[model samples]
Target: MPYTVTIGREREMAEVRALLERRGDRLISLVGPGGIGKSRLAIEIAHASADLFPDGRYFLPLEGVFEPGLLLPTIAYVLGIRDNGEAALEERIARALAGRRVLLVLDNFEQIVEAAPLLVRLFDVAPEATFLVTSRTVLRIRGERVYEVDALPVPDEAARGGERAMRSAAVALFVDRAQAVKPGFALTDENAAAVADICRALDGMPLAIELAAAKMRVLTPQAIAQRLEQSLPLLTAAARDVPERHRTMRAAIEWSVSLLPDEQRALLEDLGVFARQFSLEAVEALGAGRAWDGQALDGIAALVDGSLVKQTEIGGRPVLSLLAVVREYALGRLREHGEAGRMRAAHAGHYSALVARVAPGLRGAGQGDAVVELGMELPNLRAAVRHLVHIGRLDDAGDFAWRLLVYWWIAGFFGEVRVWMLELLGKDQPITPHTRAVAWFFALWSELWQRPTEEVVAGLGECVRLFGESGDRDAAAMATAARATARLQLPLPDLATAERELAEAVEELHELGNAWAEAITEVSRGRLAWLHGRTDDAQARFDRATEVAEASGDLFTLSVAGNHQARLQLVRGEVDAAEAGCVRTLLVSIRLHFEEGIAYGLEGLCAVAAARGDGERAGMLAAAADAIRQRVGVFDAEAFTVHTPQLDAMREAAPAAVAAGERRGAELTVAEAIAIALPDEERDRIAPALAQW
Candidate 1:
């Protein structure tokens, strides 16, 4: 299940399940207003009746589908049916589900209601297929069964007078969720009326009640109830044309938000610029040099207390987030106050600073924590980029995207970042030379080994020139190294030219005192030397790169050089040394959360195992690497090409055992993969150290 249902949606779940399970009711729709729990209820029903479908219960999210024509293709994608453009998509879908009892759950279908009629045709062609949908509006198609999901039941005024009110489904859910945040919360005589009143004020909407209950950690139920009376009505009067249910939801959010002091309110609105989880430090950066002071921490606490913000723990550190509903409301308030632009600027600036801060840490001892922390912030980083782009801050957007080039490559977000970069570049706006240079560099990195060699070469040329013009000697050298690497990858390889370029890049980086970039350039030189059959020279470069990176505390560069060094040792039959280096590199990769590093490290171990005739272990490790690569959206083609001989040898030696090992590896999660790659003693020793950051 991708999402969890609310505690009190049980009855609604049962009813929805009955509709979905009922024969001939192929198009059953869960209908409700925004924040009325329709999607959660539908998901619950789909999950509960998973076995009843037998073939598969495919959930297709249509929120991102803006064009109605893309609807069928999206469904085909979820069904794993590729469209060859030769046949009608509907026909292909019907043929695929011909004899299978598949359940197609089209979620957020309201956004693409124009495509609703297509479902009728689908049902007509495939009687065994069932369509389970969630939408705010009814499909209005023939035989469509609409299960109108409503707000959770709230106690009447009379029921609010006694203990019976505490048992109301809405009140029960509120208490349950509240206890999750603040344990010992209950419907005692001292707070029972307050709880009941709060639930009723929000009209028993599940999202509203949950948001309100989250406040119980700090505010008394009576205070919450009283605050709601003020904020909800103010918005209701201002937005009369909106649907009553939506207005109520907005009111509930506004009421909670209104309880915050001025500093807290400003912080909440500013934080709303984020579309995903953010760190405390990131929020503080937003408040830096502002009127927001030491009280900013108190502001965050207040927002969390009011349930306008949600707090979560990642890697033992607290992360804060806002629910989509609450975020939308906050954004509305932010825009209304004319603070949207300034706050978004702050958001982008903070993430840019974050990228620069973490970029250095990506190489050293605490690299794992740095990776985890940066990975956690990726969503917010992306959100900041999108916000900047949305507001026509193309220069800022490009700069923001450029700062994440290393991160996107390491974290396997190149495809996503590439899309963002292309969109930004496509915009009809003037771009500053520095931002353009950064954008081009990002494009070059993303297109590495993925794009045509000529395109990659051109992008690198432009990137290097722009970086030089921008007076960033370190960045220019990095770009020079990339161009040299690309030059060797060209159709007619230029080994001489690549060596010349690599030498110049190293010199430039060293002169600029950018040890990190210099180490990176050195690693490239090492790889080039190895390719040219200069094994001893390659080893020296790798060793030098490792030393520089270690001194600079740059884990990414060290991992690169270390992995290559381990491969060298393996080829030279230094089995113990190779294995030890691989383990250490794997640990660094895991800590840094660098997927490519982890994959390459695993592959290095695979090579060692294959060389030692340990085909089974080789296969398992290869499978683990493959899984990590697939998850991270990366493919280290160079590593694959280099290891083909070894992997083939292992497969040929023990084909069946290799197959079983691969299966075992496929089942391993990232943590499990780490555990399998490292010995028990090594893992135990690293465990406490890994958590330190």
Candidate 2:
């Protein structure tokens, strides 16, 4: 759990600590080429500055977080901030860190530079908190201090056996790791020259040196140095145009990987399909087991021994990952073998299975766990969907995309998913009627916010027809409920017709024993009653819907009903209970990664805050909800009509305060919005980051 054994970073560590401690550099990013030990150096600095940051010192790995939207939540997750559906996560984190001194380390931030603004805002809001980051490049945020981490110092070619030769930082590191495998392995009179040559040849990169030294258990230093001399340049020729250090690192990876047997080499290359960490079972399920002839364990062991793979534990489960440079190298090699397409297909198939396996739990008590799992696998899933779409594999792509509808909606990934769904639908490839129905459903769901009522209604009609024709009675019933809800939002709402339609849908859902569907219909009915001034009837409907949703373990429906129930409570002047209900639903929505739920909850909280005469807080909640609605392309026109008059009156009373609140809310991420909505009495439910560690 302590720092990895680093030999030559003492000076770098001291300088980094000074930058963070003495100089008051709120954002200090360690920038360097891949495999140059930037992450290791950052870790070392965090350990050294442990005492300076009295509040907390936490490390958040961003390698698993590929989407910019996830940045705030990922940070909150590491900080142990639980979202209460009422407050935004950004506000929660900022509130938690206000006037507090803490050290937050974000690693592998290169791919998520779009989130730099979020980091900057955090710096502004939490002035006392310091941020340490490790990336291949610097974040160009103002006031950022870039620390360049370079390779270690290597011994000269003519250096002979002595303390002086061993004193070179690179030589020292190589010797240290070499001794781990070959006990007592030292730069003796016989091999000191070859050891020095090996370090210099590896360009003093710690990773390359460690990998080369791993081979010392079998080969002599002279032979290892000879192999590097022969293979590095030839293998790295394609990358000659890259930076010299980068080229050197890639060459080292190429040389190390080349030493594996044919099967191990093949497996290593194919493993490049994974975006981040992966499990052994995923590897086998992805077809690597068949590729390796069931020798996956042996193949993985060989890669681990060769230092081509790094093994770590996540959630008590072992995960294998390749260093960034190594993965890139393997991907290039895999492409050269003309196996890219096949490997991608296999990757897509495996993730499809993963989605299918977890889909059953998305609406159950395991919804939270399901969301977490899907979040972990999101990057790969995105890649799979993209690949299938690009290759015109419409059936597989449509199926995969449709299966993630709940996930996409819950996680606020509707915008990205909408693009893919539209692209797939526009393609000329033929798809099954079932797939078509699912696609149409997603198309309507995603475009509902931005599209016109007529267009959306037509899409809904087609979706209903397709579901009906596919012999999926429950699905058809669900679609019917959706159509009825949309109709209620029309300018001249048809209360009688919509109510009848919802009733029929509910009956069908009940007959099918589909609690989730029936719960959705009940909420629609409740909304209709509430709109018609039937408060008691609406409350009863909401209660029944919540009961059914709970029994079915359907967080989506539960949260939806809770949203309406909170609105009804607000109307009845139960301010505290309304706020409590809003917070409860927000937490469930946040847990489910459902953006629509979070947005709706925030709106409810906004209305409650307005009813309480807290105009500023109300404005902030409304703005937060608007931001989420814009991001996810979803909006409830009726809800807006209901709340707007009151919020506008509150906003007019304190234009400046309300505007400030709105600005802050607009800056908030979904997690932060949820946190801000949380009442003080509910803070205990937010998990502490320490619990995760």
Candidate 3:
């Protein structure tokens, strides 16, 4: 009997064996970088795990289809379910899989995160079905075991000819490869080092090693290894006739890219201008070069098929994402088309304006995109910043500087946003007044949430000075207002100075007869008044602000003033009034899909519910508020959702809160916290004061 050729990865092989033996979880993911032998390893593991799975093994390789929505249908098709899409495919598939100990290997799934949840749900229902998925990243669902595949090992030069301690994934690959090329090429000391270097340089990723092995016929091991570092594009297939998908990284991307149409291909290239990920809105705006009408979703579908653009399931919505490598390819195309430099400038201008308008909306006292929309647009917005810097639009770059603070603070994009922002903005720029001012303020605001108080103060001071020279009076006033509030809340800025700037801004707001500006100015004034123990004065100012906001009919100002009112109510012990304000705000925010509005609503509702000792209610509201946190996309502060956590948290919390306790956490106070917590319409309907203490 011919012994089975156990390819590279003794360790991974053993782990897969162990996982199969346990058979605890229904789904297992074989995840790693491209060409890391995920498919081969999966096959071996599947065969080995055969005994554990008494049912038949079925394989569904999603090589061409990138639409994650099609995952279930694929599975249903493989299972031989007649009329899988007719009516009860899910039910039929579930029933068919109920008792069968089936092993379903889902290959190349990273590009389809949206579909993973469907499989997860199915596995939950069908306990006997075992799913083995191969992806670059884990299929992020509950109870999914991840088995990461390392690149095939290349043994040391000196130890090459020895007994197979060459048990490394690299060594196994080298031996298997060299033998195929020269037929008798031994794993000698001289060639081992060369092979090992190749594997190591290739990040020990399987696809790279295999590709290197194929080139062994023409070039020496050393030359092949060195060449791999430079020519990844030229290296195509593996020496071994494994699955076509396992050939080369370029092949994989090409397979995915070929799926797009002319329009999508052009769009994908243009989209690469963004160094950071972006949202659909960003795509629809600056990123979209070719106009895609509603019916033209097919062109987008083509790109989705090519795997050039991958969709992310953000809070149950599909948002597109591009891998770094894909981004690189698109960028080259952008330059080829001579459209790269131009789009970058456009992106900077649009987002700069976008950030400014969206920043004030963070108060949740306004009209804006829904949380879902925000989550979907995160990648595009991030791309916007990159495009700006690459194209030399530094002055407006300030808008992003302070504007993204809400994302870092209230929205919870700290980890992702911080790294991207720091790197993108850290470049050398000749500081203009506008650029310096916006930078100082935004950076300071973000730092206050992420770092020390003193550093934030330092940045704020720089902003205050720059704003007067470069920014408009409106920006100065807003900065002044935020600065003054910070003084009252924290001990960094001079309270007296903060108060003076705010006072001056208030005077200016009245002079301009700008209701929205007046509301913002009063909001700042109210915060100061509260800080200075002028509670009554703060309430009067806040009340006036709310009236003006309503009269102006501007959603943004109304929401901001509402938060102030709710905060006041919490302080004054008017639980009912505060709760009502938040609820109103919540409704308005939901309609607008405003993440900030949702945050305020949840925070406020949690407080009111908790005060009434409704733990379930409080938890629900707090959870709802928490939902909006950590979202990516346009709402990096909530003007968009492509990445906001608001919906996800709400999905988890709302159902439970709908059932009971009123738990809003320590993030906000009973009243002021409540205002910070609740909805715009509610804030508008119920005045914070005179609702009874």
Candidate 4:
């Protein structure tokens, strides 16, 4: 599309023109608040100058370009320049622009402020290139000329004939946006006043105006204008953009809100509380759709296209977000309708009930299904936790904290999740012991992760108390495993926690004599010893666990033993032994029809292979692991996080390193990797970030 206007500020455009004419090619910074038309103006200038710059203009969007080091590579990508490992960025820039006068439009440059120096250096070398950068704030580089864009032109409503009669910034924006949506949509006598008011009410901000205009495709201009007026922050600051009578952005927002149907309005408000983008399934939770899902399904699509929500692509699903300003408008609508508190309460209840149902269910045969379900509800669960804690529903809060642990571990959310769990364990929670056991396990895990002395002691203490008193033997065994895990996280002197639990579970296992449970308990015990720097003890327990699992035909337990045993062996610097254990686990998992187990086993085996300095072998194993993972259902970000990208990065960087070492007759050892960066250290960092996704 050819850019229009470089528009709005006549004086700024003149200044820009003067600078470009004099300097040949200079860096121009177009800075403004979001929705104020910085991007529009940059595009306009780029289009107008295309002929001046004989080389075609290039637009580089920097949304995902966070790191400064990646800037050149990203630019190279846009320019179709091959970026070899050692390519000099400035030389590439100079060569690319040598005989060409090219206008480069850079969008969202503020996110990479640290990279501005490099960009400036590029500009210095590439005199034939003119840079137009659009950002939320000005990039104050030396010799960079800045143009600050104000709102669009505004005119007096009474003097104007219709929408045409009003030459205001607010009206211009309304006309611009509405025409695009409802082709040739203009303010007539019927809606001219309404259009002016709507534009004026949304602060004549281009983004807000565009949003309101989209609404008019369904709503009359009047209804949108009126609905927007209800919210004060959205009420436009009485400026000269339009008539003073039509001023105030809050009015604009209120007008827009008034246009939506009752259910749509409700959905919008409940969704406003979300910080990041969410999905339709999340919005569906707002209505009483538990049994009546059709209504929610019916309303979501209409609401999305009306500009009330913004849809963003997220993996397989389309996630939605409200513009920041629009969200403020929706929040106001929430309070006005007195539905925010009620919806929050509902959210808390839904999540609390869900966790309670699934937490205990996880200790039994339906674990795989439970894992899948938990993954889907993670966002809702997080929302529920926030609602419960923030709204003072402590019982619900406790339920959320407790039930989320196993999911947390299985999903690999070991870092901040633990800290968050501790915060949820507030004073005198009225939740059941099973709930407390769940909370205790997470708290203990978090304590170990954060390396706190007192927290470790307290977390283990509670685990013992809960495990001893829990009436159900299966639940108690799960608690025993958790308590032992807590001990393993602490120093070696605390082996009593794992040892006592192992002994208790062993006795209980014989008394009840459940082979599958016995296998799980034995593997957990082995895990405890493994983490405590007791290699022999860990190996013996894993061997026993594997034997018990195989004897009972419990493939889950067998896989767990295999992966855990391999991990322990790797930590002990026994690469070949670890690989062997992982391979056995992989074989058993495949035979048992458990795809997830197979994925876990292969991932561990690949890590072992990498640790052993077998680059080609490790790559093959990792690829096999990834292929299996894609075929198996991914439960949650937590499950996804266990496949550490750091391991992947190491694998990538190690190919040549491994090949060279091998050629020199030096074999890589697991101990060498251990000395570099512990496997746990990498897993701990990557897991939580993955879960958040």
Candidate 5:
């Protein structure tokens, strides 16, 4: 048996055993695509069916064999049958198993499929011997029962829940492999969806999943999911024991592609234009002007049969997509052939037009459906933006960014959009003044919580001036509110200027009927009020912000206001109310995938714990907040300063408890931290499994 634990093959194992037990089924072949665990499953079946072959069991790997004539010699070598110059190799091997119940396992027979006919000669000589073979292609000889091995079962939407995700075979295998590299790694609520996404993105192939999980030694599951856009280079193995072909995902995929015909190979590379799933009509559009001789349907069927392109159904229509690893390999071929630029342009143009049609629904009554629709197409959308920016289509890129603003904000993709905007602005090309201003505003908005130096404040001021001159009153007002907030955070706070600008911006936004902008500006007003020590005024501002956010369906802003209000509650000695508010905010933030909001929620809960004199809990929550802040590369110096006194007091009162708590919390995932922060009754009711961690 292999050293690594085998995951989830109960059905295949039972079927293989039943076939082997049948009177005529003496030779059983396990067939599947490369890296689909055909070899691993064969080993498992052989180990489990040991009792039937009590005389002898032998394993031979034929991966290095290239000529058909060398098959008998290789088998005789493995069985330790020497050429004594008296009998032929095959006759000697047959004599060794003539009258005994023996089992022979042949691994990696695809490299020498021509030698498959030799298996019948040995079976004819030995009456009671059973042969088990693993190959990517089926051996269509007599008495050979083929067992098709598929990829592990991946988690779907319903199985994305923390506990249900763990039960999925793909996710379980990833966790098991990840633990082999980083022993402390575990699947938790915070990373369950990302882990499931990783499994699905790899198409649940065992070798690919193992290659991805090995990255846990340096990257988080969320980070791995994000980096999978170019997964080939990131998913490589350094272990010396594994075979060379299995050491990298690309190597394994390339081996399979090497076996395809020239025309089918070209079709596979051409299909790389699609970033994700595509219908038959979509693929036909890609082949419209190409010089391929065969039909697109025929080529797709060949690739599907070869396991290079997977065919699935969505909404009663068949769709096709390449596994992330295979797609990356195909894309490399596209780039090598100099067709990537042309194909990428067509892909970008199609998605850009599609987003234009869907932009309006993002803010209308069909917002929920729109969000789900856009989420499913996020990869294609991202690819389009990158292509546009790369080709210096600045105006189009800016238009696309602005059109998807609401979706980006709601889906917690502010950082990604910020990078795209910065890249677009970096190109020294002419763009509309309004486009430039909007780009600058978004690029600066993502870093609003960082220490606002003079340079940052100056940039925001420029955005405000350009927005006003461009005749966009709503944008101008939003920029003004942002500039005010940054000005207040300066080394020497400009209270007079901040207060005046915020009032004007809020009044203008409200008059313009922009509920989302109004609500966000109101939160800034509350922060200013808090600085002025007018606690009642601050509470009223936050209440108004929350009310407007709820009415406008802005959960991100609602979480922001809730966390601020919870901080005030802690200051008022209302620990229970503060704790409840923090829990509510955390739940909303988790749903939105808003990391910054989650960090704030943790900080607020830390204050509540400190007020209750639970120093350990307070220290743990504070450390977890720090971890999130560090990962996202965001820091609020002012907020950290405000919490310093409470943290210092906890440390001074119970140094040992605080230190131990910090150690434990530094190891917690967001889900684990939330588990500890939840109220006792609720934590026990909802996440009893995580309590121990």
Candidate 6:
């Protein structure tokens, strides 16, 4: 259709084809961002489906026509319906194609989107005709089925090898374009990674890939990729054959932005502060003091309609995002208007307050929902923290990081927070002692399992002093409990000291009415009791921990205590009770999206399977647990030692089956592994949430 073959759009083509086959979908709109190959895909679909329309397949190129009134006349001209002063143009066109099963392909309708209603009217008059439209925006008329044309799939890091990289649609397109520009150019082992990098950096947009590949006439793929940091300037094409707007990625985006109303355009520029997806609440907060404060929602809808912003749901709440290229363009507009600094400060302030407000909820009854909310906003949260730190607001950054301590720990974001805290602690500027103490605690806790237990205990001892001196007795007691937990992990653990400190910490937490911290302290005590071979005492402590966690509605602590009880159940040879306990804990962990808790639940299930002589199932669950542990950067030597003996016996009995199951499990995602570990009924109950994840 465009002198080049289409690449990597088979799924889209099939989906659009299916829609077209449906009689109700008379008006099908292929909508996406500029350079996403919408026009090309529409032409290919129309050409391929020529047989479906018995009359004819007509193509009308509307890129040059910008006026709304010219649209009807243009369609009339394309259909060869000359205006002869007899009837109206629409009537004549409808009469000419009334009974004909024709297909009309309208290209570039975004500039004249106001005329969209005319297409519906035309469709009403000519019942047998189907209109296939390619636009940067949706038409929003009746009977219009929008098919979003996404960018081609690019190779991820794992698939960046020679032949593996070529499997990507984006890479294949780039190779085809490169060979056209420079004959015999192939994807070799040496240059494959560079090509993959270029494709990914360009976000897999077709026009951008073609433009970059055209540079193969002189520059290497590596050189082109290196220059892509300033991609807006580097992605221009010098070919006179290409349209002026299509010659550069920037011009293509500008053409779309030029068609927007002033309010929507301004809102888009202001929204450049978000580094990732943002919620409507976030949009409202960021717009609070701006001139368009009350019009943000309407403006966002308009931007979404105009294809400048992408809208999706996370946790059943709508979230908006911009493509990397579009965001870059919006950010450039923001800088040109000199509002980048002000907007970025507002964004950071909003997210900082957001995390602070949700921090308490993460520790109590709202733990599950709060964790999901924070997880949904994590990218924005990270961006906010980085911006705060960048603008010399170390105190605010550290405070925000500390407030989200529970969320960070649950979502496996502690490593990232550890880096931010390290940067904050390294700064020469002064911060509040409370912030300093929390920052040190985060830095130490993130590496508690990776680093030596002695070092963690020593660092946490300082945190305890800082929190106490800063008048935060709750934090001080929490740190005291953490120090004791670390001591219990040491080679020759000071059991007596750990027992004394835990007892003191629990009493302090209880007096302070901090049930969440008290629950955690009890779990530590339960672990201590179990180590001492005091089965009755251990069961009592775990039961108390569970009771406190349930009272406080702390899912994290509940999962912890539940897993501990499950381990005791297995020790007592109560297989059924142990399995039930592990499944219950897994449901709680999945609800909270707590990777560590999920891994522990899997480990408990693995032990149950081993006890039942299901070697394959045990090995599968164990490998899955290990995968989560590796991803979360957590290792529990004590727990590993407890399970090691049974796991070894299972492996020894059925080595091949265990090895095969381990390989299969290692390849599963967290969600897939959860499916394997859960019973069908429980999985069905959690399907909706897991699907969102």
Highest TM-score scorer: 1
Q: Candidate 4 on 250-314: residue-level lDDT in tens?
A: 34445556667876666667766654455566556655743334466656666665666766664
Instruction: Give me candidate 6's TM-score against the actual structure.
Output: 0.62
lDDT for position 412 in model 1: 45
Which stretches in model 6 have alpha-carbon errors above 4 Å? 1-247, 251-262, 313-316, 572-577, 612-641, 650-693
Predict model 6's lDDT versus the native.
0.79
**Residue-by-residue lDDT tens digits, candidate 2, 470-588:** 89887888888888877776676778988998999999999998786788789889989988999999999999999998997889888988988887887688888888888888877
Model 1 misplaced stretches (Cα beyond 4 Å)? 1-6, 14-32, 38-149, 155-167, 174-201, 210-237, 255-267, 279-294, 363-366, 390-399, 569-577, 635-641, 650-684, 687-693
Q: Specify the poorest-scoring 10-residue window by lDDT in model 4.
A: 668-677
Candidate number that wins on TM-score, 4 or 6: 6
TM-score of each: 0.75, 0.73, 0.51, 0.55, 0.55, 0.62
lDDT of candidates 1 onward, in order: 0.75, 0.78, 0.59, 0.60, 0.75, 0.79
- Tens digits of lDDT, candidate 3, 1-693: 112255756678787777767878668888776656677788777777667776678877664334454465556545534221212446656765766688888877876777878887787778888888888777789988887676555555455443543566666766675566567776666666666666565555554454456555557887766656555444444313433334455543443344345666677777676543455665666633354534235655555444355556644555565654566567777788897788677767666666666655544444344222443445446556656655666555445755654443333344333333344457776757766666555545544532336555556656666777774665676666656655544545467877887788778766756556677778878877886789899988888887877775556556667766786787687888886776766655444434566566566655665566555555555544543342211112222121113223443555565344324442232233335444555544534331321
- In the predicted model 5, the residue pairs found to clash are none
Where model 2 places Cα greater than 4 Å from the true spot, the runs are 1-3, 10-32, 42-148, 158-162, 183-192, 236-243, 288-291, 422-462, 465-476, 487-498, 559-693
User: Cα RMSDs of all predictions?
Assistant: 7.3, 7.2, 17.0, 12.9, 22.6, 22.2
User: C-alpha displacement of 541 in model 3, angstroms?
Assistant: 1.8
Looking at candidate 1, the ten consecutive residues that score lowest on lDDT are 80-89
Over 251-353, each residue of candidate 1 has an lDDT whose tens digit, in order, gives 7767666656677777777777875577777778777655565666777886776667778776577878776567767788789999888888888777777
**Model 3 error, position 181 (Å):** 37
The better-scoring model by lDDT among 2 and 4 is 2
lDDT of model 1, residue 369? 62
Off by over 4 Å in 4: 1-203, 218-249, 273-286, 289-294, 356-377, 425-441, 449-455, 466-476, 486-497, 506-520, 527-540, 543-560, 567-693
